[model samples]
Target chain A: MTGPDRPHSPSGDGTPAPRRSPWRPRSRQGRAGPLTYLVLIGVTVVSVFPLYWTLVAATRTNAEINSVPPPMLPGGNLMKNIDLAYDQIDLTKAILNSLIVSGSIAVGTVMFCTLAGFAFAKLRFRFNNLLFGLTLGTMMIPPSLGAIPLYMMMVELGWIDHLQAVVLPTLVSAFGVFFMRQYLVEALPNELLEAGWVDGASTFRVFRSIVLPIARPAMAVLGMLVFLQAWNDFFWPILALTANNPTVQVALNNLGQGYVPDRSVIMAGTFLTTIPVIAVFILLGRQIVGGIMQGAIKG
Target chain B: MFKARRRAGQGSAPYLFVAPFFLVFAAFGLFPILYTAWVSLHAVDLQNPNESTWVGLENYRKLFSSDFFWNALENTFTIGVISTVPQLCIALGIAHLLNYRLRGRTFFRVAMLMPYATSVAAATLVFSGLFGRDFGMINWLLGQVGVNPVDWDSGRWTSQNALSTIITWRWVGYNALIYLAGMQSVPADLYESAAIDGASRWQQFRYVTIPSLRPTILFTIVVSTIGAIQVFGEPLLFGGVSGHLGGAGRQYQTLGVLLYDEGWFNYKLGYAAAVAWTMFVIIVVAVLVNTTLARRRWRNAA
Candidate 1:
């Protein structure tokens, strides 16, 4: 973290000072001038406008969306659009399916990655660095490179339309392991594990009680990231899950591409699909931001 | 100094703890990739994959001569450069701005992540509507400026730009936040010293901040390059409703879309695997090149 004179650190007692030029370095509050705020606000509008547009369109009739100057405000047709989307597409089923797949992957990844991460961070084992490096290196291999054989394997196993086809393949995230290991190595002390071992607590017991409890905050961040990724995934879901078993993303795509594509209906479906991740983001904004930055900086 | 001895009980525990990943990764991650390489060398019919015949290098040979393959590679490079350059530049600027103590700091930071957290499928669907030729908001705005409405997804350059816009929109904020983190760690004292030496804001940023952020910049560029090359969902959605072919004339077909097309639609599993292998090679080479260039720059700066 930067010091008091740096940008983010608040001035003691939190009173607004006279406006200063952002170009001039301030020794006090370090607050940005008006110009900087103007630029940031503009950037935020551009960044957020599309989602706003989607919401506007989702709540409006098709004619309103197609108007020369599109309806800038949300309209009264939101429930109507939702009803049409629900009746035409299996919106509820797709959302439920997405929840199941994403939930399983998130929980599974957190548990598995944490266990391995604790071992790597705490225990002294043969080839520990080598194993950890291998895990890190695997991050470079994009899963898409194996699409053909994965589909074939799924076909061979008759898992083509099964949720596990999507879930099982993505459970072991290399980045998740790397991220958790880094956190654990920094957070949990060696003496704690040693104390548990000296007290004749089994390694599993120590990991279950001591490490897991302490590592909860790190796990929550990792779990949120993993869940968001699984929920937003498209290519694999489209390839694995057929029409009968569409995830929310797939279902939304189908709605968008249907024979008589209605913009409001599709937008309604898109809105429904996007809400969960956005809600998660809003709820855990600080943690998610920290998780992303920490992962990137460490890597 | 509390190093527990890895003797009787602890010896196998670490291995047991790590076994789940190895087991799952071998079966799912590593095995399938190796199997794909195996499949790349054979002429495999999707309908009857068991009857795959070894064709050793023929798929590669065909892939090299194929117009579609070359077109896809060209499109991928075109869009990757277009998207990557501006995405990083804009992200750098945004990070610079955010580094200052603005009012509503948390609100702006959280707002920056909104685009990143949205699903690609959903984002693309919204974007496609916006980029639509006739009644789109983009075209509507352009008309106000006395410009004709252009068909975005039809032409090669236009479609590529359209897809690049989608990629840039989704990733810019994420990258900006990363750069912001790097900026925060740049030792604020350096800026203080630079300012004391009577350096202007621009000069201080150019000389001090940029130099300090070299490693972070390199890190982001390499990762972005890899992600850009393997861009899938944007092009896939932009391609059309059903076809994995990038466009009517394969205009915006990236390497990812090409791989999917060859495998699923054409049932040319062997050739698709070749495409996948080729993409993997290109990414590895690109990463190597980026690291070497960045390291050389670091050396020169030092």
Candidate 2:
């Protein structure tokens, strides 16, 4: 994209885009460098190799897997495995359930977090420092620390079987608020708020109209992060929806947890579940990382 | 328009603005933990929540006396250290390599982070198949190199090895992206100037790259320490599902698994709460220490 975006380099009389030495160049000891390059490539392969293997392995049958060596390439029978997995976990219902759980969690967290972040950033108030400090301080506490009581409370409220049990408790996230506040405090201009106030605008109105529009990019990053965390969460759903309303991860866990497991079907299920999250990173990978860096730099 | 009710001396509404956070925190965050402590002081049973006795620090005493709890603590710390040190090193090194100017760097950058986007459950499942002793690829590859098969889940050290394998696979890429962000902030001009002064690559990196990445290193340490310390899924799954006690002798178990076992499996609410508090204390101390050290480093560097 960058190659075609610029027709010419400014260093010369507009000939064309500058060239490169393939993917990378090296010094005179370039031979030594490919070893380093090989190491880098090896690590990269090790990283994504499992994914490739899963894609290939999902299509093969158990007899093929249990051979002297595994199949090094893809095979047919993908449809058969998918059919088997559908009956095993009710793949359609599980996907819908996961969507509901992750979607509600993401949207709810963003709404509340944005509202609170706007208040902290644009609203004038006392005890703000102390409250924000405590908010930042809670990042230290691990989620497992409160698992037992949260479970008990959910049970007592009779919210155990509902999706709200998982969704409501997680709807308010500290990290999201912190990220949003960091963005809003800077991105929102003071003069705009002053003008709105002079025109008799309410605080909430000012925030809803002015601040939110400017903070959309950061909000996207926060929303994505929260969604991923909730999507990939294992502990909460496993405990909350152990038997009934099993999430995709829990259903996937159930497959391997059972006796006489169908490894091919499990692999197929694994491949299917990973698509949404992998797609997220593939699209917004840089922006997410950059957003994190910006927040951390300020923090 | 909400008017200021300052005649009664009531002040700011920021508390009102942030009420939802506090409410959720109090209900789910503070209340549960405080209740856990209260429950831990009493002898509560799952069958009868009403018929319980207040037994004060006895739960703590029992935990101290039990060798199973001690083994789980040891396993947690061992895996935490083993996985974190090398994981951060690899992350830092990869981030450095990634910071270099090259063609198609974005492909490698995004590709490197691909592992983290995969679900842990699926990743662990595949890793289990790979590390399986019989007909597993790792063993088969070892055989080609004239080495013998390793029973990965057979013993104590093997348990850590298996657990670390899963941890490294899941997190190494996530940390790399963060570190890549860190390495990018380091001005390229610093290195170019250092090169002009004939500073070797090793010297330039040691003086510039290492120092510049201090905050990121600290960030990773704080986060990785918290994560590894509270590791649950990989160990639990690797320990075998329904093998809730985490192996025959509680060998590979961490605090999260143990707490779950005590609370959910055995129905010992009070005892599990006590374990959770201990885990909380350990995490608190770690975060506090890292923050303090980070502040000092920032001050000295300034």
Q: How do the residues B1-302 of candidate 1 rate in per-residue lDDT, one tens digit apiece? A: 22335443367789998889878888888887878778999998777666688999999999999999899999999999999999999999998888776678778888988898998998898998899998889999999999999999899999999999999999999999888878776666687788878887788778887898888999889889989889888888776665388888888888999998888788888888899889888999999999999899789978
Candidate 2 deviant stretches above 4 angstroms: A1-37, A86-88, B1-13, B47-52, B291-302
Top of the candidates by TM-score: 1
Flag clash pairs in model 1: none
DockQ score for model 1, please? 0.53
What DockQ values do the models have? 0.53, 0.37
Interface RMSD of each: 3.1, 5.6
Q: What TM-score does candidate 2 get on C-alpha atoms?
A: 0.89
For each candidate in turn, give its C-alpha RMSD to the true structure in angstroms: 3.8, 5.2
| Model 1 Cα lDDT, one tens digit per residue, A62-143 | 9999987888999988888988998777888999999999999999999999989988888878878899999888887778
For residues B94-128, could you state the per-residue lDDT of candidate 2 as single tens digits? 76666554456567766777777777788877877
Considering just chain B, what TM-score does every model have? 0.94, 0.89
Q: Chain B TM-score in candidate 2, rounded to 2 decimals?
A: 0.89
lDDT of 1: 0.84
lDDT of 2 by residue, A1-299 (tens): 11111222121113232354443222211122554566678778998888887877788887776567678887896888888887767766667788899899888888878878877786766677787888887776666577777877777777776788888777778887787887777677888977766666666666678777887777777777788778888887887776457777887777666662667787788777776678777898766555554555534
**Location of the lowest summed lDDT over 10 successive residues in candidate 2 chain A:** A1-10
